[model samples]
Target: MPFASRRPRSYASPRALPSARARARHGRNGRSPVTGPDLPLAHTRLDAFEATVQATADYLQDLWPDELAALRIEVLPMPDQPPGVSGVARWRVIPQHRLVVLYRIPIERMSRLHREDDWHRRLMVESCVFRAVGELIGKDPWDLAPDRFRHW
Candidate 1:
């Protein structure tokens, strides 16, 4: 009679999921016992993009200490481009200020080449920023950035 009415309970939110320490103590599987995979909700891609730009900026500042004041960093939604050709800007460099204009959408699109990997997406953003700076200064981006800066 006691066992007749008994039923298993369930957890609604992932927050109720067991912690690593708890799991280890109980000696359960690494993943959630009920759920197949332990995958949780993902964070925003905007935060990731911001972190990439900040990292790239820090690297550039380290590379060129004195010249940092002269160059400007601009983040725009998308680069001004012709319908088919995106090589929109005709002017070689800004007459007064050297600028690196990073178009978020275009770079994010390029980052889709390796959808799952974060390093690839970040590298794309960094490389795009480097390329923009190179265009402003009229130097090859490879020459400006370390060989390790290559993106997938």
Candidate 2:
């Protein structure tokens, strides 16, 4: 039968939720055919991520004033990953220089509140964000590393 072998339709990547257009589309209503109140909230959390990203960028800029042009932030969506109760907001912390700092974080408060069934989604999303940034920057997020410049 023609229907027997039909493939399921694919969806837009979950990673797109953090984009500016997506954020504007979701707005305060958190209403979308593809996403619900929960997913919109995840999108909202991106505000926190963006703030942190800016802060980190500012800090780096101050320390490396000479190389500030070399340092910048780039965000990319990791859509190939799965989706559900949890999602990861990952991006690249690339610098023109060889050395750059990277940070990975999880909304632990959100995870604790998620239903048991969604634990995997939370972990998977968080892991993807962490790993994606690590891969892009050629370094992992950690506090143990020394700053590229201490003169500032």
TM-score of each: 0.55, 0.30
| lDDT (Cα atoms) of all candidates against the true structure | 0.61, 0.42
lDDT of 1: 0.61
Q: Residue 4's C-alpha lDDT in candidate 2?
A: 12
lDDT of 2 by residue, 86-124 (tens): 665333334443222323343333334445544454444
Candidate 1 lDDT over 1-152, as tens digits, reads 01111133456635765677866766755644453466664556765775677677667667766655466665556656658874543222463656555666667864546455787777777877676666766667787656564676
Question: Which residue pairs in model 1 clash with each other?
Answer: none
Leading candidate by lDDT: 1
Candidate 1 ranges with C-alpha deviation above 4 Å: 1-43, 82-95, 111-115, 147-152
**How far does residue 110 in candidate 1 sit from its true spot (Å)?**
4.0
- Per candidate, the number of residue pairs that clash is 0, 0
Instruction: Look at candidate 2 and tell me the lDDT of residue 129.
Output: 40
